[model samples]
Target: MNKDQVKGVGEQIKGKVNEALGKATHNPGKELKGDLQQAAGKVQKAYGDAKENAKDNVKRNAR
Candidate 1:
């Protein structure tokens, strides 16, 4: 996987942990922060996926 993909997955995992901790501790701010992090991670992952797909298409068409 690309750097963006790896970082995005890491952020998602971190967000999930933070979200769980926030829920357990009754911290709305932390929970909201986690939710935002997850969303950002998702966007980054999608961008990485698009990049991969484009690269693959280019390589295939080069033949």
Candidate 2:
């Protein structure tokens, strides 16, 4: 796991908490923000996964 992956996962967890809190408090703005944060986190995680995969591929091919 790389930095981006770790951070992405953290962001996702935070977003989930915010979303839940917003819902419990009836705040649409916060809920929307949480949704966006979650989406961004997903994208970041995917980027990290791709980066790791590419690195592995390069190593394998260099052999």
Candidate 3:
């Protein structure tokens, strides 16, 4: 996968860990931060997916 995709997945995993930790520790702020991070990661991953799709489409059309 591309850098963005890899980074996005990493962020998602990190966010999940943070969220679980927050829950276990009863920290609402940390949980919310984790939620936001997860959302950002999802968006980034989607962008990477779109980029890859577009690249493939371009290659297909060129052929």
Candidate 4:
């Protein structure tokens, strides 16, 4: 997988951990931040998927 995809997945997992920790500790701010991070990660992953798809299409056309 590309760096973006890998990084994005990492961020998502990190966010999930943070969110769970925040919930366990009753920290609203941290929970919100984690939720935002997870959302950002999802967006990044989607972008990565789109970019990879476009690249594949280009390569196929080139052939």
Candidate number achieving the greatest lDDT relative to the actual structure: 2
lDDT for 23 in candidate 3 is: 100
Model 2 residue runs over 4 Å out of place are: none
Ranking by lDDT: 2, 1, 3, 4
Q: Candidates' TM-scores?
A: 0.96, 0.96, 0.95, 0.92
Off by over 4 Å in 1: none
Q: Which pairs clash inside model 3?
A: none
- Comparing 2 with 4 on TM-score, the higher-scoring candidate is 2
Lowest lDDT 10-residue stretch of candidate 4: 1-10
Which of 1 and 3 is ahead in lDDT? 1
Poorest lDDT segment (10 consecutive residues) of candidate 3: 1-10
Tell me the spans in candidate 4 whose CA falls farther than 4 Å from its real position. Answer: none
Which candidate has the highest TM-score of all?
A: 1
lDDT of 4 by residue, 1-63 (tens): 677887788889888988998999999888888898898888888888888999999999998
Candidate 2 per-residue lDDT, tens place, 1-63, comes to 899998889889889988998999999999988898899899999999999999999999999
lDDT of 3 by residue, 1-63 (tens): 677788888889889988998999999988988898899899888888888888899999998
Selected candidate, larger lDDT, 2 vs 3 = 2
Worst 10 residues of 1 by lDDT: 1-10
For residues 1-63, what per-residue lDDT tens digits would candidate 1 score against the true structure?
788898888899989988998999999999998998899899999888988999999999999
Q: Per-model C-alpha lDDT, please?
A: 0.91, 0.91, 0.88, 0.87
